[model samples]
Target: MDSSTHKLYHEHDFDSRQFLENYFSDKPDMVFGDDSLTFLIENFRHVFTVGHINGDILIDLSIGSFVHHLYSACEFFKNIIVLKVNNRCIMELKRWVDDRTGAFYWGHTSTILQEKEENSDQFEDQNAKLRSAIQHIVKYDLEKENMTDPLVLPLADCVLSAWLLDVISKDQDDYIRYFRKFSRLLKPGGHVILIGVLNITYFTVGKDKFQGFPYDEDFVRKALAGEGFIIDYCKVQERTAVSDLIDYKAVIFIAAHKEK
Candidate 1:
């Protein structure tokens, strides 16, 4: 968790605006579709996004979809708070926000220290290396008083975590603990939206290797049910991109609401 790790994690100058511009220019017709964005706008007021690191390109897609959905659903803008373990991801997200008109808050652990450090070299990509380095450095950055802390944040209308739980731990108990911690942040009747790879054995982002839990639809459903969240919907969708390096067949999108 030294300064070197911090430097590595925050070393990306990803042009999100340019990326989005290219994306929209290519697919202008479907860029702001009516289904997903409409759903997001009609349901959530405030959003808290987690697990968006620079190396993880899926964050761009996930957040982009969420934002587009919100914009199409609501006339005015809403507040957005992004929580990431990697400084580079936060920086890129901040840069993306700078060109747009919306309120955003960002926070992360200042160092690369984690509770467990056994599988440090799991992924072997530069982005994964930096992300893993940041995770190693900021393992304990989430404090009880911080809004980024999964257990203590104010009830949010919607909480989004993309590809987070699998990277946190391989043990199901540990995964459940993490999910429970995140569940505490939602207000009664609020919703949780998550996307993850199912049954993914392993993958590389930058220079770090990632081992995913053997997650299936049943496991996720049971986990959410255990947390008192009623599963409103779940789907398996494909993620297609030019930077399609990961071998995940489908991305699981889940929408669950807390009972009053």
Candidate 2:
């Protein structure tokens, strides 16, 4: 397999709609199942509910235009700043934020969060709150020293990313370098939460395959430790969804805070 053929996410024009339909949609046979959705939502709810993790500002650097993971965080953080590597993803997310007619439906995810929280808020209201909490959605450049250059973003009290590092990094050294840049957004002693798929080498969207950097739990532990972060919670779940769209073996979630 020529790794060169596997494009980094930002290097190619992505099919955002196709990507959402294949993975994030609520279809019964979606590549990522309801269990994965629940896993992400429940874990976020628990981490934020623990009291210490909640903060005034949160920086979100997740891959794609997905906002399902933010339902729980909206309640904890006063504001959220989303950074994206491409304008396509930024526009897709803005459609949802502006309540456009053809935006991706995320009501099911809202239902999951409501069920987890034991609350019965209407889906519209839940989504509206999330939209309100989002302070800005800006495009970024990975090669730049300050990803969001010309606009120095305030250091956030917490940084959260899902399935981003691997897709954007070409190798282990790149992974660590990117992680260090990511962590620089966090205030000292602030927390970071990461959601990743283990052993996934590639994923397809609309016939275009993108590369993923494969790694394991131990590597993540060491990566965080080397970055001066102390892990507080970690969980892994065997792949529950049956799909060929991606070859991930499992999913992992980690919560940690900078030791400085």
Best TM-score among the predictions, by candidate number: 2
RMSD of 1: 15.2
CA lDDT for candidate 1: 0.44
Candidate 2, RMSD to the unseen true structure: 1.4
Candidate 2's error at 85, in angstroms? 0.5
Please name the candidate that would achieve the greatest lDDT relative to the true structure.
2
Error of 1 at 82 (Å): 1.2
lDDT of each: 0.44, 0.88
Tens digits of per-residue lDDT for model 1 on 1-260?
22223211112333333333333322444332222232233332223223111111111113221133222112121333445555444554444344344422111110111111244342223222333222111111422444343433335566666556755545688778877766665666666777676765554343333455657778889989988888776666554433332345456767677788
At residue 132, candidate 1 shows an lDDT of 27
Question: What is the lDDT, from 0 to 100, of the residue 86 in candidate 1?
Answer: 51
